[model samples]
Target chain A: MKRVLMRGNEAIAEAAIRSGLKCYFCYPITPQGELVEYMARELPKRGGVFLQAESEVAAINMVYGAAAAGVRTMTSSSSPGISLKQEGISYIAMARLPCVIVNMMRGGPGLGNIAPAQGDYFQATKGGGHGDYRLIVLAPSSVPEAAELVGLAFDLSDRYRVPAMILADGMIGQMMEPVALPEPVDPAEIPPRPWAVTGAKGRPKNVISSFDLEPEGLRRMNLVLQETYREIERNEVRWEEVETEDAELLLVAYGTMGRIAKTVVRLAREEGLPVGLLRPITLWPFPYGPIRALAERVKAVLTVELSAGQMWEDVRLAVEGRTETPFYGELGGVVPSPGRILEEVRRYVR
Target chain B: MSVELAIPRGYTRVFSRPAALSEAGFTYCPGCHHGIITRLVAEAIDELGILERTVGIAPVGCAVFLDRFFNCDFVQAAHGRACAVATGIKRARPDLVVFTYQGDGDLAAIGTAETVHAANRGENITVIFVNNGIYGMTGGEMAPTTLPGQRTVTTPRGREPRSHGYPLKISEMLAQLDGPAYITRQAVFDYPHIVKAKRAILKAFRNQLEGKGFSLVEILSTCPTNWRMSPVEAGRWVAEEVSRFYPLGDLKDTG
Candidate 1:
């Protein structure tokens, strides 16, 4: 019930620990380095295992191992490190292991910079690695939401036996905000992982693997995964709408850009532009239905991001030519101002 | 009295499959040493009475189906990340015995970094490394432990150090690390070498049971089908040729 000011990265770490994280493994990278440092200092105190892995690849594999061992596990990294973790992530997804992965975003195609960017939207929502798979992606626009969403990420991952991701950026990770942290979960009350490989004490030996060499066998396994994804899509679509009741134009964004668009909406409304904002919280089970329905009434929908219009394609898919869809993005970690976003809105509104 | 009358009914069973190994038949090629090595490891588990508390990590090579062959709980790792995976399992459940069964390509080439770092961190786990000098599952491709002048599918005209680089001495390299409690390279070509290799596998597993950190037993194995030789001729090659480059014996023992 007590609100305490904490940095966004550290708040996420605290939330994970409270959510009964058994093991934390990661390699250091920019913007998210504080999260690792926080875990290194706090996780051991809570009787949890903390390891600074050799590389991002090793870190994700460690998560896979711990998750298979029937424990809540996690790994954090920035842009470059997340790319290195793709192989393990793919294996984890196919293996149907439950784990949390946090990517505090940074600019990149290569090693762009340590600054904030939303360049990984495509990678996070789409298949970043090989094979047919999807991650339950959550994007938090503020430190408080970031902390709260960490718990939801763990829960949804465990509920569906799927990997979940917290996609945030440097601005949220570096900034400080007041947050009332979630209560620490009782480890005994955590959901039982009947399928985990726990030494087969009194039961049949459990074997955790994602490989099925036979054509028919592999097809069956993939179909099961697709069914689970459909279930998630049916139930887990989440978003936030503001000032949308009678607005003529809609603004779509997420994470850092989404929070900025909130201000842009207010600024545009004050100038009688009649703008509303739709912020997607779940990036993969994206708010397509909401966007599509809003597009039916709005004159135009504009997407703003920190990248060169990566999430814009998804907006267009949701709109489906119901209305005009325009994209405005700033590349290379540029944080566009509210006034700048309002100017883009003015172009679309009239 | 007859010899059979002096012993109990069950006492006559001297050479049966270890209880730790399942009834599932191994999928390895004929004359491959994986069968022997897996049996040896299972034998160690049975002898140590830890089958109920042991977790095996299957690598992403020919032994990728290692989970099917073991009665104990098993988790399959991504290519070359067995050591890291084993480390995670062991650290998460320290009460459970964890070990990785990895081939040369899965341990020394693509996974070299994970292998080295796991050893360096002194993660309390056993590593059963099988070095056959070529990528057997991937059709006799050149491996990190492939010997110079050895001809694999990738090296059609024999491995040239100028182009392919030198064979990696993983045991020798890992032995230098202070974290390892045991590091040994043994072969399984014939009776004597097979006996020694079995002993090495037991020793490595025992180290994990005793809470010793990072023990690796590199067993020089055979790949007859990939080597384009008969089973008998491949065993001879392991004895006469492969043993020369990867000489058998203990490189380090912190015990």
Candidate 2:
């Protein structure tokens, strides 16, 4: 497809439609409103269902329903709205249903500001809702990447029967960039979901449920989910490394903070500093292996984010005291300029 | 006296389990109305010949295990979210039949917003609202539909309107909306009421088949074990006491 300038939210919506999204349900929230509007206008024209639900709770449940019916479905929201969706997300996870969810993160603890933030790292990577379940969390750094990751999210979610999420921020959601959108996926080419509750015609009935009153049965189900997650961890860890060959200082970030760190890397390199960037694309099955390997050779790792060092905790776990791990973060939806981040890199780079 | 009669010639079977229902025994407590309601729904499905393409959304209450007793496909939704789930199913595959089986707490309390909005949107789906006055599976907790002075585990002091608030008549409230095509409050307290309740359930499914939009049948049922009463007493309570607060008749039918 030809490259076209599109807002991050519009690009994601277009990408999801191309990825064979048959049902899209959402409620309006800031920083992601354009995504909903795009789906409302474009999805129906392409023969898909677009429903603006009564609330975030209802929207996620609608996604649950559509996914259970063996269709590619999705829902998007900002922070507080995402919190309301946690319960339904947990249900979808337990049922082993495949669906895509996009969270254009804004400031939060309670109804936080509409500015872009990376505060939902813990909620996205870790199990936000109650249960021993994990979603395939993908972090995208730019408009094009955000659009591309939506397709990957759907594919991984369907392949594993596990829900996948696009963990972006308002910065990416609102920013406009030229993107060569992915080719539309043929709905007929999608894999069959035999377990989905389509109907009982010509076969035994299919039941999509998370309720197992028996303790032993529930335990076995959890074990199966754990095994699938382990397989995903083995095969799906993704990251991007920039000039890490002979660098002594490493900068680790993702999403909006990641793109900013890329700029910091360029400026630091010009100033005779050996600073490399390690950006994780998948936040759940985080790129712990590559970070651990690089930490052994580097003098220190500086973690940058838009929150109070949420992902920094994961970096520390990967480094495991093998090297010094410094952290720099800007909370409350503040986006630090590359000049400010380069100064932080100057302190750590030998 | 136990007597075994020989099979008479030309004797025809009149009633049996609905084909849409599985042969498995129900998990409901004795005299609980879920079994009867389930049978009615299954009969409706069978009568309409939609068993092959019908999808049922089971709620989180006693009917949580509803998948086991149904021959058709079933999706067990979270507590109070069946209506939203049903909307998803029906919207995604309009040719399929979708229905939600929800209890009072699931429908009138936690899921009030989902139920009301789905009905208000006039989503083409069938909703079986089983109002048993109290939460059965959760041990007789006070439901939104719990009558005043009705003693439940949460309302042991005899529900006072000042603190506990009044019973929520959801069917009437939903009937006031323009979305729902058919909204009715029925009862299964006696033989005649049971027959009428079956007809109401059948109509709800039929309305969905005719593409008339959202149809909900609120069947006033008995929860004997949770109500701390015998089967007969519980049925009597639903007929005499519960029926007074929640009138048993069609609130609206847009046919």
Candidate 3:
């Protein structure tokens, strides 16, 4: 283990290298460029492959290629660049190639500014790409969590043979923080992939493909993907529940907003307001069970976000008809401060 | 007495023997050039003995099922995205031979940016372009490679320069770049033309094997089904009308 003061983006690059991912392909985009730069410098030093592809479209396809070749690979970009990658991401998911994608999200719809925004919540958690595919989305609130989740992402991706996304906002990517890099996993010890395209000599040719035009064959493939997602929902639901006991108002948030909401929770506690925070780590297999449980104990569930009520929908679903759910959010890259959230908590508590 | 083994007619042992292609037969109309070009490329891959190490990207359009015929690692890319996908494969595993098979609409229209930049960056990959002057898979619509004054489903009254624009000379544009190691335009309409196309295809693949930069082979082909012409007439049209706009020859050869 090594301790280093690193920016969130650098931490992610370092963690990816430590996770035994040999290839990092990406195109430079705002806020997330540091991640690609770090990999470009560090990967070669560590005897890995790093390339600046022609565009986000190419970078993602490179990830698909490397993953199909049975090497751990990744690509990172901001919101607009990620939209360009959706096509490649769809193919990766359809092919069942295990790889990681990092979206250091910024405001969007189209080139909506470089400031941090959770506007990509739906794009990341729900399928951003076309088709009936879901990426295992993990949102990291802190630099350490961002670093730690890289390894976890590789594990989950390979285990399930599906793409995993590390959904971070600009704040998490741009902020500096202390992080202890996890111990390096031995690459030799990892299980061998029989499907890798490593020159099929003395064996049957290994084919990596996403097309099954036959209706029955396509249905079987879709069923396999669905079963894998169901397993993920059952086994990988994770969240942080803070001070839920005797709480009158429950706050649901994630990623950077959740971190800010935690501060509000602390302030509300000091003010004698009974409030709790539920931070969802896995945004896709969203920790709804814990949220619903918290909603049962509280009078109102306040869903706070940096986007215009994206995650609020999930909160409503979890607490459907069970309790009153209100949304408080800032749109177009405007992030709500802890004070604003604390005030909202006070109103909900009273 | 010693005897030499002879290969069967219309079959070459050097080619991968068409295992991945369906015996149920091709979906292409008679005289369609796509089936021939596909076979030629597949044969080249077999001759190079790189079937396992090859990753073929198939673009949206007529040849989307190229994966089904190549028997290699195949990925279907969005319309005009085969080049981008091929760039990805090449960058990820330089050891693997990555190639994209694309139609005129895919290569010259929506994917133009990707194709131009990939070549400009001197990406170590091969691009196999099939130019039939019209969108064959989409009801004979006019394409970026569609000739001036030519009529199609979209250009029923004939293509006008003021509205539809002149056909783009992609091979010439690509050949102008110093980054690309090889660029050639060939047609598969006649026996001699097929021989020329095979040589161009071989050179493009060889450049990648030699660690040379970008290479492109633009094949002037026929779309009998979409062009609403007989297979024989379509072949003749490729030789006459298409060749006049896309002249067949080596535009650049760094090697």
Interface DockQ of candidate 2? 0.88
| Model 1: how far residue A143 lies from native, Å | 0.4
Instruction: Report iRMS (Å) of candidate 1.
Output: 0.7
lDDT of 1 by residue, A15-48 (tens): 9999999999999899898999999999999999
Worst 10 residues of 2 chain B by lDDT: B1-10
lDDT of 3 at B169: 90
Residue pairs in candidate 2 whose N, alpha carbon or C atoms collide under 3 angstroms: none
**Decreasing DockQ order of the candidates:** 2, 1, 3
Tens-place lDDT per residue, model 3, A1-350, is: 55789999999999999999888888999898789889988999998888787788878877876777688889999999999899889888988989999999998778898887899988888888889999999999999999999999999999999899999988999899999998888998555778776555556556677777699999999999999999999999989888888889988889999899899989998989989889999998898888888777789999998888889998898998799998898878888789988877777786
lDDT of 2 by residue, A178-201 (tens): 999999998888889999888899
Cα-lDDT of candidate 1: 0.92
What does DockQ give for each predicted structure?
Answer: 0.82, 0.88, 0.42
Per-chain TM-score, chain A, candidate 1? 0.99
Q: What tens-digit string does per-residue lDDT give for candidate 1 at B1-255? A: 113335566666556778898878899999998888988899999988999999999998899988988899999899999998998888889999999999999999999999999999889899999999999998999999999999999999999999999999989999999888899999877888878888888888888878888899999998998999888998989889898888888899988
Give every collision pair in model 1.
none
True contacts kept of each: 0.84, 0.88, 0.38
Look at candidate 3 and give me any clashing residue pairs: none
